[model samples]
Target: MGDNEAPARRVVADYARPNAANARSSITRPAIGVNRLQIPPQIITMVTNTIQFHGLPSEDPNVHLSRFSAICDTFQEQGVTEDACKLRLFPFSLADRAHAWLESLPAGSITTWAGMKEKFLDKYFPPSKIARLRSMIQEFRQKPHVGGDAEAEPGDNEAASRDPGSADTVTDSVHDQRGGTTSGEPVAILGA
Candidate 1:
């Protein structure tokens, strides 16, 4: 049988066969020092929105991490089991670009919620990458055009027309290194 195939039929067959009294006792016995605790299943009654890749862009790992933490908190608050949490988080990627990477992993590679989270952080927000992004954000500067009006700054307009990617040009949409919309206003990176 393939490694991925379930052993349900074999388990059923074993259970269906009649066993001798000694064999039954041996099969039903629990090992010493092993605790067989049964936890009650929790019913998720609240309707919570699922996290989607669209909401988390690849350039914003810090924001993605924050959002992921919130989702995990919500899952815990709703009484989702650890295993269930791992399964639930599989569909939710921290970034749109990461979705394919996550899908490419072998089935059941991430067996626990903690393991999945660790893998995600290691892949997307490595220490060196995070530091580089932070440096870029810190060095970012916006050069506002003189006179505040486009009509008043024909020279600046002409310069912008000549070099679209010039450092002196101010963009209408100023995205920080973490990809958060600053709206030209400076914003502190979360968890920085």
Candidate 2:
């Protein structure tokens, strides 16, 4: 045969020839049991670094809520389940009065993070109070002081000129209850 034509048959078979030793056995293997395919329970590693917070009287609900959110975030980043999140929260909850309040609830009341968060907000930051505070802050305006001897006092200007770097020499525009502009430091409104 020509070099291009080659041989019609290969010198050796491409596949192995079957033999008694390699032949399929007549004995049938037993069927696999369902248990073999069943998945095993996953083992979850508990969180090691627990979050710390001061007890209630000192720590407000807002502060606890923020810390709680941070703890939840940490659990989520670790691929922990909601149940694990609740479990992780247990230690910190017992640490603070605010947290303890939630912990004191009936068993199963806060099985999930959502439920826990709801209870926490309801107890600490009531909707009515939050709304009222928000509205009051939004409506709040500084009142400007009307003309007075205090305004005419050149002593303030003289002091400012005397010591430009002095903090006491600073003059800030303040609004009074009358909504008039006055030259003075702004007064801080407590618990507003």
Task: Name the best candidate (by lDDT).
Answer: 1
Q: Can you tell me which runs of candidate 1 are displaced by over 4 Å?
A: 1-50, 54-59, 75-80, 92-96, 137-192
Candidate 2 lDDT, 134-181, residue by residue in tens? 999999997663333334554534433546555434242224342555
For model 2, give the 10-residue run with minimal summed lDDT.
Answer: 38-47
- CA RMSD of each candidate after superposition: 16.3, 24.0
For model 1, state the Cα shift of residue 112 in Å.
2.2
Computed on alpha carbons, the lDDT of every model, listed in order, comes to 0.50, 0.48
| Clash count, one per candidate | 0, 8
Error of 1 at 134 (Å): 3.8
TM-score of predicted structure 2: 0.42
Candidate maximizing TM-score: 2
| TM-score versus the correct structure, for each prediction | 0.37, 0.42
Question: Which tens-of-lDDT digit does each residue in 25-86 have in candidate 1?
Answer: 10111222324323223312111233444433345555655665654455342433545543
